[model samples]
Target chain A: MAEECYTELEQAIQVLVANFYKYVSKHSLVRNKISKSSFRKMLQKELNHMLTDTGNRKAADKLIQNLDANHDGRISFDEYWTLIDCPYMVYPATDLCK
Target chain B: MAEECYTELEQAIQVLVANFYKYVSKHSLVRNKISKSSFRKMLQKELNHMLTDTGNRKAADKLIQNLDANHDGRISFDEYWTLIDCPYMVYPATDLCK
Candidate 1:
């Protein structure tokens, strides 16, 4: 289908899906999941503008602890979605997406 | 901050967040939640190209039923997020965003 056929919402979803794979593809060892270290790097490199304290390893680890539903030390697709959603879900008024 | 400062990932998240309010703000009585009726309208209008059978009321109702996590018959923000994410998370290879 042509790109113009997609609505804004659909395009937005595409960006998110593509982004996950973009990061995941960076490391072969992790396969479908993002290891703890890779997740940290993703945060530092990709999410620094929206998220604070990406420079602090301790803060980043704490974030993973909160979003790691299975406590497996790996960030799955679901976990990654939830992590990116924290700001929007918690404070819709002060959301970064404005 | 300048829009250019945001990374692609951050911009994508913003689009998702902005889209939520774009729909939610349409109905005053629903508050933070998207009523069942409004949710159906959102699907038919915004997701028809990506989701099949959007014209079918039954399909739309079934979708809300699955995404209604609290069983409140209303689509909350998180519920909406999960619903939009189903296509991507379930079939990453055939994701609509691509």
Candidate 2:
């Protein structure tokens, strides 16, 4: 349950992250340790324009529903984390691919 | 557990959203229904610069750990959502501030 949700958050963040790839990626505040190839790979998914695009946040809202998983009508930190923590695990894997 | 977690997500997002104040908020994709007054308030918190600043994402990493909350070492969507959902509840109240 948790893994599925964070997978979604990572999906959403990566989509939105494309928004600042050029600016934030080079800023050093976040780039010193993270590998560029992993960064690029994360940036590239669904990247015709925005892997992070909320093109129809209806999709986002629905995912929010999924994150809430238990049907509590509100998402708890645990549920939400499941949705967003995918990158922690994914980045290293993407690096291995490179 | 959930409320405490989303409280954190909201806290972190407001900080990050400040980064896009000049650009993303003005964009139609995300702003249509999310009230501007609430938006402004979100932009203002810890606003010397970045409410969203990862100035020391050590803070963020720590929070991520909190979202994971279960000592699971990996955050699930449930945990992540809790950290980021506070704004959804706070916005209507912030509009009342206006």
Candidate 3:
């Protein structure tokens, strides 16, 4: 793909989508939804910096509550995007890091 | 500011948030919302590759229609996030570019 033609925002969005697949691909037997354990690993490994409490299982559970809209205890792409968008929309990244 | 500790997903979220402020900063006197014209410019320059129809005024306006939830013709951060999350959640970036 000729990625060079894509602007920063477009490329950034691609990075986000690609990151989801990256984790899903690492786990076998799952393509559409991330299992509960896999989602935990994703939060700890990929979102540790943004979510300082990712190591806390209880906090992680609370975070997943809203994302798992169907209450299936699994995360679909839509659910994952919802998780990302909520904080991304509310807080500045710099402040989040601090 | 110790960015090295941040994971790829964390940084990607930062990029998305920073992109919003980048445009907002460029246009003075407005910190909370992007005017219709500024939003158009953002779509044209930042999403041209992702949204091929960005060059068309009607298409841009139509895209903004849903984002402007209050019907005020301006995009607040929540509305902007809504606009981005819709397609980002629905389509794969590679497919969207195609």
The number of the candidate with the highest TM-score is 1
Whole-model alpha-carbon lDDT for candidate 2: 0.36
Clashes of 3: 0
Cα error, residue A73 of model 1, in Å, equals: 1.4
DockQ of each: 0.61, 0.02, 0.58
> Top model by lDDT, which number?
1
lDDT of 1 by residue, B1-70 (tens): 6878888877778888887776674567767788888877887788766776677787778778988999
**Residues A1-98, model 2: lDDT tens digits:** 23243323232333333332332334455442223343233234322122243333454455555555667454444453453344422222222112
Better of 1 and 3 by lDDT: 1
List the candidate 3 regions with Cα displacement exceeding 4 Å.
Answer: A25-31, A88-98, B25-31, B88-98
Q: After superposition, how far is residue A40 of candidate 2 from its true place, in Å?
A: 25
Best-fitting candidate, scored by DockQ: 1
lDDT of 3 by residue, A5-79 (tens): 777677778787887776664555656788777788888888766666667777677777768999987788878
The CAPRI-style docking tier of model 2 reads incorrect
Alpha carbon lDDT at B64, candidate 2: 46
TM-score of each: 0.84, 0.22, 0.81
